[model samples]
Target: MGGSPHTLCVPAGCSSSDDYTVPDALCGVTVGSEPLAPLLPDGEKSVCSVSVDKKQAVYVTDGVTDAETDPVAVQRDALARMGNPQKAAVGDDARIADQGGVAVGVCTYQGRRQKFVTLVDLTSNHPVPKRTADRRKALESFLRAYLPKAMEAKGCRK
Candidate 1:
């Protein structure tokens, strides 16, 4: 948390200069590629980093060079797309919009601080479809493979 946030573009020798270590493992988990593959454009790999502090944590990933949106902003926009209501449940107090990219989850851990926000944002270079039904379905499929391990890595609990 002491250092500035940095982005890394893998295979291009980009470095993550932030205080946090990039959780590259998020990209290589056993999740089926079918759900995530189409969401990404051509010739991009799923790379990710975790930027975390005491009260919040964000795990963002994409197939491109850098994240185009902040996790909080992505969360807000995706939620707004759902008419600003807390919909869809993925265990814990998590809400995932049906538009296919951002999820907000509340994690509880035993400490002076009892809760924190764990945001998962899957940014894409390609524009999302206007209908979003297909994208939403794909996102849910991808999260089934990505979310549990990501939360564990973030030291979050349901």
Candidate 2:
């Protein structure tokens, strides 16, 4: 797939959490494989944006049934990921827009880290109140593949 320079990529061996090396600057990233569902249309994806550093980890999902994710809880978890008892930061509003049937979520863990953005596609079927475990896996996979590129991209962020 062709995209702008800011388009990031995740690395291999990121199938699990402990295997990931959080970007020194950007902790946010898009993870997952392509849609595995026969009913799901091509091009659209169940995107999840995860920002994790040595200080914290933030997981955001869109195009799923759970938009009720508590930012406070996420912040706590993110901090725990880095073994930091203090909460670093949390995006009060994190989501992907369903643009004309294409659902996409983006997360830019700016300020706390360096500068980078992770865009995830959840589905082509607009926003709905439902989620599946498969989608979660897809998100993790995609982010694991591309988070590093986003975090390390120089001159991409403002």
Candidate 3:
């Protein structure tokens, strides 16, 4: 195999939580809502918009609520609402709700102590039923597309 050896990157001085820096803005991450099409109406096309709140740690698309105090708390709350979330093979740590309406992904970036957390919600208007395999897959697909871009923007090793 003709390939270059890649060196493993380890964060320096990563002992304290304060050493990690959270991303101030996520609007720079380029992502489309196309992966989310299946979650919406057949004829409807939804545009993904980032919240401009400076308090938010990452780019929170429309459907996702901005983190007010703690991102980890937000993640815990989202997972709680999911009832039962299936582990996703997306980012560092990810979970997709059984109903396919909610998905949360977490990725740790280089030089930042704070991990980038993202949430996708499709159950805003109505309650999503349980055990929706297809919907869960769709949510997984969306995270597949969204997480990489967001991670790259945050300077994660590809």
Candidate 4:
């Protein structure tokens, strides 16, 4: 809300993508952090953190909606507007807000271990961002630029 239209812009900060090796345990992981696990009876691991919080519209473009776009304020407005459903059905015009944070984390997806830098939503317990191709590519691009400068250790290039 305090910031510009790019509210809660965390600046997409991340650790070095190449900061760590595959730790020998995950050397076979040729693929990135795509989820290889099967769907459980419960809806677990069905989402990624990289995607915007689309449960509801964070900011309504309605003339009466406030100009403030702070993450907390937006969430409050969105939930209130959507009647606080446990799960909200989003429409196309609903614009979600910035997420919890951005960082590179080592995670096991589909049994393959890989490093990924993307926005993570800690409040909701989501690990990485969404598994979409475009999201992955954006994370890869961030890592390519961030890892070199952040890690400085020459041997571990991505």
Candidate 5:
């Protein structure tokens, strides 16, 4: 596997038992057994991009406000479910409300075999109902295209 130039040390006070690191400036880490390339956007520098090193994937945070957005909550809940499948039923309402409104991606690291979830905010100027619908559609499209590959690469089912 290829070595990643960036290392993300776990911050103090985190209760996770896994020792994970990510590239500098990335918000998430990847996991797998193969060499993973950093996901970069064309012609962009540090504003919007995602990168994954062996066994670790990193996503740059966009800092979109989520306090008033059900989609954000739905996305978070879904990721949590990925970590614990049993929790899927708990956030169904939020999930349905935010349907097609959230964006998600995954990356893998060959070193630790861990997958990280990446969420992108897609705020809409349309009315609340329309915005939510649009967001859900966009997110669903992204997941359909990229998620299966990521799951296969990471050896995860969800």
Candidate 6:
């Protein structure tokens, strides 16, 4: 988008004739002149125009997506892959935690299997650990049920 006009300011109390032409990089683009062509219409084509401010507000670029590496789905998948639930702990994998922060956590069982969960915290810094024995079992069951659904919702799993 075109920017605002460049101004050449004279020294304090100095006349315009005494002002120096600032470097092009320092001075902004001139205003009220014809805008560069791609922005303008060519030939008989009807052109629709929006102001720079309005254009900025209306337009945006598309984002990229990945299936296996979607943070939340990956975490759930990783946890399911690990198999054991008792050994799971928060912030276990430096790489995943670094990428997703507390949005990821690991759950290990009997030190044999591990599972990861993502987006367990919408805002909190830590996942709420299952404390009691029965609660842990319940939590594990909940993860098994919910993880697949969460992955599917993110379009990361079939």
Best by TM-score: 3
Clashing pairs for predicted structure model 3, backbone only: 20-113, 21-113
The RMSD of every model to the true structure, in order and in angstroms, is: 12.7, 15.9, 16.2, 19.6, 16.1, 22.9
Residue 40 lDDT in candidate 2: 27
Q: Tens digits of per-residue lDDT for model 2 on 41-152?
A: 2221123222222211233232211334443344344324322232211122222222111121233334322223333433233211124333344334444444444433
Q: Is candidate 1 or candidate 2 better by TM-score?
A: 1
Q: Give the distance in Å from residue 66's predicted Cα in candidate 1 to where it truly belongs.
A: 28
For 28-139, candidate 3 gives per-residue lDDT tens digits of 6655534533444321112333211122111244222232334434566666675567677876557777533233334334443445566765544332222267667767
lDDT tens readout by residue for model 4, 16-114: 332111111111222233221100011211223222323211111111121232333334554344222122112111222222223332333334443
Q: How many steric overlaps are in each model, in order?
A: 0, 23, 2, 9, 28, 14
Report the backbone clash tally of model 5. 28
What stretches of model 6 exceed 4 Å from their correct place?
A: 1-85, 88-131
lDDT of each: 0.42, 0.29, 0.46, 0.25, 0.30, 0.27
Q: What tens-digit string does per-residue lDDT give for candidate 1 at 34-115?
A: 4444333322122342223332222344221112333445457656654333444543334555434444344444432233
Residues 111-150, candidate 6: write the lDDT tens digits: 3233333332111122122123433343333333334443
**For model 4, where is the 10-residue window of minimal lDDT?**
36-45
lDDT for predicted candidate 5 compared with the true structure:
0.30
Deviation from truth (RMSD, Å), model 4: 19.6
> Which structure among the candidates has the greatest lDDT?
3
Using lDDT as the measure, name the better of candidate 2 and candidate 4: 2
- lDDT at 73 for candidate 6? 44
Candidate 3: where is the Cα deviation over 4 Å? 1-28, 32-34, 43-74, 99-110, 127-131, 156-158
Q: State candidate 2's TM-score.
A: 0.27
